[model samples]
Target: MSVSVMAATAASTTVGTPWINITIFGAFVAITLVVVLRASRNNKTAADYYAAGRSFTGPQNGTAIAGDYLSAASFLGICGAIAINGYDGFLYSIGFLVAWLVALLLVAELMRNTGKFTMADVLSFRLKQGPVRVAAATTTLAVCFFYLLAQMAGAGGLVSLLLGINDKVGQSLVVAVVGAIMVLYVLVGGMKGTTWVQIIKAVLLIAGAFVMTIWVLAIHGFNFSTLLGAAAEAGGAAVLNPGLQYGLTDLSRLDFISLALALVLGTAGLPHVLMRFYTVPTAREARRSVVWAIWLIGLFYLFTLVLGYGAGALIGADRIKAAPGGVNSAAPLLAFELGGPVLLGIISAVAFATILAVVAGLTITAAASFSHDVYASVIKKGKAAPGSEVKVARITVVVIGIFAILGGIGVQGQNVAFLVALAFAVAASANLPTILYSLFWRRFSTRGALWSMYGGLGSAIILIAFSPVVSGTETSMIQGVDFHWFPLSNPGIISIPLGFLLGWLGTITSRTLENPAVAAEMEVRSLTGHGAEGATDH
Candidate 1:
């Protein structure tokens, strides 16, 4: 049958195995919950709770990192994007993969060496503890919330598609269930449990993608060129060219650059990914983790390229878009086309795992930021009662989960990858410049840190709120509203530079430089891992 005919039929009907999908998904969740229970046996101290007691090996931690990094955006969004936009859609994969070099060379080992638990730990090392920690924690929570929204949205779309629930109420219930599960994971497992879940999810996700990739290639005689030709014929010859998505208007081209910039710089600032480094014991292990993660993530992105085009060739974009879950339905639908209801069930399970794991990771990171940084360091004056912090963290987890559920429900139809890009823009704007300055510049002051974080965060948030993403267009979150003034959907192009500029300006204009002796100690510790282990517990 022609691809169009096949897709047209399947578009109106789901794979006809909601029970199978639910059963498979339920099994995975039960298994992971057991793992979390077992892992929580070691949650004795703040370090144990937040950084896994630094017990994980390099490769293990690396695998977990890949799981945390390759979010729903990478799987569902990018696949659907490629199925629709072709070459331009693959740019997200490129930007995401290339982002690791920044993490590896600039942040990974250095971060692991310098700080004990959170990103705020590193930022507050030499600077004024109170102000810097507040700024850092605020930004951390904001980034986590944004990232959480993407994962929750993906969960809603993925599950709703599987069960054939097309109503807003059904999708919202799906998102809430996901949020509750994520809360359970973080509240029970803490970092150690979350890390283990991430590792298992990483293995399953990568393995599933590999199987699908090979199956697709085998059917095409293992020739990529053949796959591409078929895809072009199935969709259009224009699928072979650039600008299918981004070249429509000058504004779109600029938006592409903004998206690329956000993706490239965002990882260095992602709190959950940064926290992954703390799971390992030594700086060397941290570097090794990055190396392992790079290989794994790079390989999986390659699989996505094939998977994307394969979907385009096997099922036309129009049908994929018309289906439940909108664009995010492409991968699951492709699985159904290739291997019927069984593969669809399995793929749906893996997709659910992807969203669940990432959200759990983000939730714990946010919880840690608040309990450790704000409540412990700032509010308690660095003397939180032992065990009290974790209690606070558990509470924060529930609150964050509730907020994520509401936010996810608000953003149902948007592409998961595009929403993730906005999160990246905020991370890049609010955190990266401050982090780079704190590591590299001796004159970088507490004033600079505050300026950079707040300016970047404020600019990014204000611009996003005023941009077309929130209103003014058909695809926007708010319909029948036309208040958008910012032309680009993403604000990275302006906010990122403003962050850097503000940091520089705030530093040079300060009447006082940070104590030179403190700066020297930080420089020595950050670069050489000297005194980093004996560093203050906070």
Candidate 2:
């Protein structure tokens, strides 16, 4: 049968059940509760809440970094891409893992040496407060929104697939439970507690992925060649080489390149991932931790390819294509099919944990930007009492959590990969340039940072909101209206360049207004691990 016919049939059959998902979700909440309660007690200081008092060790921080970086997109989207598109799906994993090189060499150590709570502090280190705050908050919120959407959408899909619940209830529950846990972590456990939660989740996800990989490989007697051949036979060679089927079309190539740029470059710019580096006590430890993270991330991704292809071979792409969720159902359905009900339950639970850990990281990072940068700095002129900043940060966490849940519940029918790519493009466009300029360019000024943030962010949003991928006005007040501002769905190609250009222009315009004293202090602090070195800069 053709792939389309198989997919149509899969959507009609309720092949797998959802009870195991609910049971595992309960356990996730319980464990998270214990961690939150423990972390809350020691979060009396801003440093503790914001940077985990900068006390985490390498391995611990490494796992947490993995936890922060590995979102539902990596788990579900990549798997589906591979099952549906073959090697092109695996390309996402390669690009994602490769971006760490930039982070490790360019960002990891420097971020630790520069900012206190958020990336805004680093970008605004030498600039004026208002512009810095606005830019930082904008970048933080943009990335968080898209990232949260992907996670929430994934949650809805997972719940629907595993427990047989509708998308609305499944997504809302994920947001509610995840939001609550994240608020608790920020409010109660603070950074220390949140780091632990990430570590635990990362371990579970990797272990779970490995178990599934091994089970699948064993079922085929550990022969990778045979596995690929089987998958190809079942799904056709095009599934292994998406280019074979779609490469001839310019539109398809553009889509592939857009997604690749977002996945590769965006990883270094994600606030949640960057925030984790600050939790380490020293810049050196932060660098070392990334090494561990790279290894862990690479291993996990390598295994996912096996899992995806193995699922294609064993569970049969036809079976997955016939499922309601199409390619997205490949992972769980294969889990249930190959490992039976017990393994199926475990896979569902692990998937839920992946979403929870990822969303919690994104929510906390956004909250930190609001509380530490916007509230503590802008609203109070940096005079908000010692613990007031942390208090405000916690409150902001709760507020952001409510919004994330609402947003997740709202964007229900969107494609999971598309949602994730939007976050990446926005991150690369708005945040990356400002951050790079702040770190490397001595001439970078407050105006330059602000313009880059707003310009890149604005351009990307305008383009994406109107892009054919988002389906701009068909669902709006007007009926039978359709428009696509951009032919290609992804905007990283243009948005990322816009950011770099804006930063350059802003720097040239504001050269004379740059603060020499603050710039010198920031330079020293960013180069060295002395938060105390640039105390006067703030």
Candidate 3:
């Protein structure tokens, strides 16, 4: 689209009063801040600050998990992707939802039964502490930082579009503001407060999507075929096929497999999602929570099928690509088309809430890994003064918020879902192998843990840094640069296998043997929730 045509598109979208959107965003911020303040009162201990004292019921924590899991990528990016790419886009929804089954069957209850505050606790239980903790914390920070980037970028685009601020500077400022608010939520309310925000956001998000889905269906006389027919009529029959986005080349097809691997395996290793398991009391609650999360998340993704096609049918793919926020503008634009300004404002607020809740969850998880795993355990040798670790965590939150703001600003126009997939790839590569080994493999050693984490992490980052996603293509983060050497956009296919192999090699090659007794103890504890919450030595 040309500049004149783009301006007309923007003018039409911005016909809904921008101030109304601003008011809605501001009101959400004020209310959530108040909730954070109220939740902060009982955050007097590290357990309270980190795990909410394990007081949340199964259903409550489950709802918060849904809130954290269903990010801006699910609502904005998936819708926009489907609007543009058709069948290929809905694959993201499938990959994300199927990931929960991994969490449920393999990870959730086992992790909750064995670990206390963080995943490091579970890994370091039977292994050497210092090297393992440091490696675990490093990988945790890496995953959380990448995840934060996606949420922050989504915030920037959504707000800039709502306020009609087309300039990059305005969007950067919007991202910075979001980072600051996220920092406050972590510093004050801690996990408890972040959980509340996520619960509220999740409810609003699913509710909002439900209403919009019904509205879109009703507009087409409550017929599913009519909605799909309209989408085909507007775009083409190609919208109904399998090869819309990833079928252009053999390399792109490989990239899709890499992306699928990352998405399906990544959630099992995500630090923020892993930390959520600690918020509940027992293995049973963790199991219940995952079940709840799976059902709720599945229902919401079904809504996306309607919402995405609805946007494609009503807004048209070309216009969405030319809109203020590019592909990320689909859901909000669909709202504007369906109910004008009022619906636009409400939908925008919900999207921002999704961004805020997810970022805050990521922030707290990153900070906890640093303070709990690195500072308190590695640096202080588990003898840190009371309340001092939490103080250090608060400081780390500020530093992380700053970096997330800068990173988000740099990757403004990228798709939030694609960015999240990169995070997933990193998680799958760096963390998943180590986690599975520690929990299930009896001979997994500290050397094995360290090797798997650093090898997987280094390879994933190196590949991403040199991939077309970063510099080669027009839509790359760094446009006008051709430094990329990697052909594939995602590195999961290469890095994830390397992680597993390195772990096995390091364990077998280590001169010192691990104690069989400790491994057996861990197996018993992991399987039967024996000493998770009660054990204080970790």
**Top candidate (lDDT):** 3
RMSD of 1: 1.8
Q: Between 2 and 3, whose TM-score is larger?
A: 3
Q: What TM-score should be assigned to candidate 3?
A: 0.98
lDDT by candidate, in order shown: 0.90, 0.77, 0.91
For all predicted structures, in order, the TM-scores are 0.98, 0.92, 0.98
Worst 10 residues of 3 by lDDT: 7-16
Off by over 4 Å in 3: 1-8, 12-15, 536-538
What's the lDDT of the predicted structure labeled candidate 2? 0.77
Give the TM-score comparing model 2 with the true structure, all chains together. 0.92
Candidate 3 residue-wise lDDT, 286-315, digit = tens: 999999999999999999999999999998
lDDT of 1 by residue, 50-82 (tens): 999999999999999999998999999999989
Stretches of model 1 off by over 4 angstroms after superposition? 1-13
Q: Relative to the unseen true structure, what is the C-alpha lDDT of residue 157 in candidate 3, on a scale of 0 to 100?
A: 87
Ranking by lDDT: 3, 1, 2
Clashes of 3: 0
